[model samples]
Structure formats: C-alpha cells, structure tokens
Target: MGTYLITGIGRGIGQELTRILLSRGDRVIGTVRDPGQVPAEWEAFVKNGRLELLKLDVRDEASIADAASRVNEPVDVLINNAGIIGPDRQSTLNMDFEGFLDTLRVNTLGPLRVVQAFLPQLRRSPQAKIVTISSRMGSLSYAKSDRIAYRASKAAVNKVMQGLATDLAVDGIAAIAVHPGWVQTDMGGSGADISVQQSAAGLVKLVDRLTLKETGGFFDWQGDAIPF
Candidate 1:
C-alpha cells in the first residue's frame, strides 16, 4: 500500500479520507491543529497500527517544516485538505480584512508551505501525487457571484497547483487541483449536495487515474476539468 499524508484530519472530509485510506491498507499520516481534537473512534485506528496523527498548525510555517521532517517514510501521496471558512459570510465590501487574510493564510499559503517543506520526501517516492483540494467557487469564470475571501484564496491555490504541476513534471510527480464538490461538512454546510464519503471516494478515484497529461488541470469530483 502507498504512504499517504493528509492535513486537517480533525473532522469532515479529511477524517473520512483517512478512514478509507487506512481501510484499504494504505498508511495514513494525518495532521490536526489540536491533538485533543482527534476523535476517540479514530484512536483505535492509530492504536491498531494503520494511522498516525501529528499536531500541525498549517498557518505556521515553522510547524509545517517540523512536521515534514517527521515523515521518515516516502510519501506517495500528499493531500492538502486543511482549510478554513469564517462564519460571517459577508460580501466584499462588508468583509473583515483580518478574516479574509486569515482564510488566505490557511487555504492558500498553507498548502504551498507544506508542499515546499515536504518536497524531499515526495521526490523520493516512486509515484508522487500532490492533491490540493480546491473549489468551484474559486473559478474566476464563475466568480460573477461573491464569496470574497474563499473565492479569491482558492482561485490563487488553483494557480499555485498549476505552476507546480508544470515545474514538477520532469520528476514524474503529478500535482492536481480538485474541487471536492459541495460536500456536506462544516465548511460545505448542511445544505450541500454530496456526503463526505462520496466526495472522498470520487477524489481517490481521480487521484488514482492521474497522469502527467492530466496534471495542472483543475477538476471536479467526476474528473471533469474546471474552467479557470
């Protein structure tokens, strides 16, 4: 089984992805901002030898570097799933600048820092896959509506993933940007259309099918390329 590293494992899609990966015999290295936040049920998985949890604050670059150093084994896959959405949900004019910057720190810069810090481990892998969880709302083509901070941050991440895909191509690693769909989670809210399991499963399938040809393209849960 492949070695997988995932962030934001405290809850939602990240937690479900960790569970599914472990069930399929893949080793999971998950990061949670607070170690205490790890669910008790998940502890059994850690105890049984399939999963590992680390305290990681994605907003902190030093923390990212420290965590990256702990992965002694090669990482076949790195899923940048950690992100945040503030509760205000305001329009750009009414949005809080501090809050907007906070979202950008977690959603955009966090993945870039992690990918940079962990490049060594990823380079050592036989088939390296860097999967950044982007969003349709991030699509500049679809930005007739307003989400202000989230939209801008995710859109920036999409570009980051695209550039990385091109730069890392010679190493045979595939860097993919994917929208997980409107998943029912804390961030997606109760009205979202898809369950976390459905989104996670589809994402795993998409990652499995990733090739250098598909790298740098933004995609949805069904693997359809999303317009920039």
Candidate 2:
C-alpha cells in the first residue's frame, strides 16, 4: 500500500516490478519513454487507479522535474531503474567516446537528477527510501575488461548513491544500490541465468527490508551485501 515511483517501465525488470507491485495492491507511478509502448497488462492497472504511467527519460532533468511535479502524493519509495548497455564498440583500445559519455549520463547522473527533483515528495513520506539499480560489472573488485563504459558508469553511480546516503542520513531517508542479477531480459539477453520474476520478487523483498542502517550499502537482489 505504499506509493512507489519507478523509472523505465517499457520492458524488462521495470515492467515485471510494476506488475508485482500492482498485484500486491501498492500504488505505482511508473515512467516510460512512450506511454503508447506500455504493455496491455500494465494499462489495465492504470485504469483501476493503481498505476500512473508518465513519460520520462531519466537522462533529461527537465522531464524528470516535470514528472515529479505532476505527482501530488508523497513517494514512499523511488527506484532508479532506467539504464542502457552502452555502445557495442565501447572498449579500452577503441572506445566510442560520445557513447561512453551518454552511458554515464543515463546510468550515473540520471538517478541523482531524479532524486534531487523528487526530494520534496520523498521528504513528505515517513519511510522514504531510494533504490538505484546498479550492476555487479560496476564493482571495482571485478576486474573485467569487457564493456568498460557500462562498468564505469555503474561504478560512478554506486559512489554517487553512497554520497547521497551520507547527506540524507539526518533526514531519515535510506538510499542503497542493488544488483538485479543477470535476468533474462532484453538487456540481460536469453542466456542470462535468472528470470524477470525471480529478480523482481527478490528485489521487492530487499526493498521491503531496507533500513537506515543499510543505506549506502551495495547488495544483490537476494539482499546479500556486495563488496564495493
């Protein structure tokens, strides 16, 4: 029964998370690039007053501010889920510099933009929590060369969220980063290990159990603490 705001509900983990939240009677405010692109199942929830679908591109700060202004109710939870895999040509030797920058804009600064814009709504809620979807590839401990752009972006966001947690501590707001696992989605691909349902379900549980003590910690979908 909490008012949850999520970004990027067009497909993948975001869509599944919206479905699960709605099924449990929680009010969801979901964002998608195109409102027409939303699945039929999600549209049904919209008609029932359980879901509010907004057009938002996380990379655009103006659009995020507009979306936040439209939502009159306090946001109990804000999930920064929109992200991209970056250009395929991204590598250490030959990198698409522009694409790499765009990746960082979306994956790193985007969440911070949304958080700052929605601070008013978040403060209105007694149990405010901010969750950013980061990836294991971002971990500095994992020394992988592939997809350097994506990895760097995620790593930057992890640090950004950590700073946010520190600054928001006195306000009683919890902020944490979570890895949704390698789920079988358009981004995770067919060969991925887990399904959208499994990732989304575990993430919901993690969100429910989030506390001020765990803020700024990086964790997996199952709530296991991940080494930074």
Highest TM-score: give the candidate number.
2
Q: State the TM-score for model 2.
A: 0.98
Tens-digit lDDT string for candidate 2 (1-228)? 899999998899999999899999999999998998788767677888899998999888889889988988899999999999999899999999999999999999999999999999999999899999999999999999899999999999999999999999999999999999999999999999999999999999999999999999999999999988
Per-model TM values vs. the true structure: 0.96, 0.98
Instruction: Report the Cα lDDT for residue 82, model 2.
Output: 95
For candidate 1, the TM-score is 0.96
lDDT of candidate 1? 0.89
Give, for candidate 1, the lowest lDDT window spanning 10 residues: 84-93
lDDT of 1 at 104: 91
Encode model 1's per-residue lDDT on 45-153: one tens digit a residue.
7898678887899899999989988888788999999998743764766877788888899999999999998899999998899999989988988745577788889
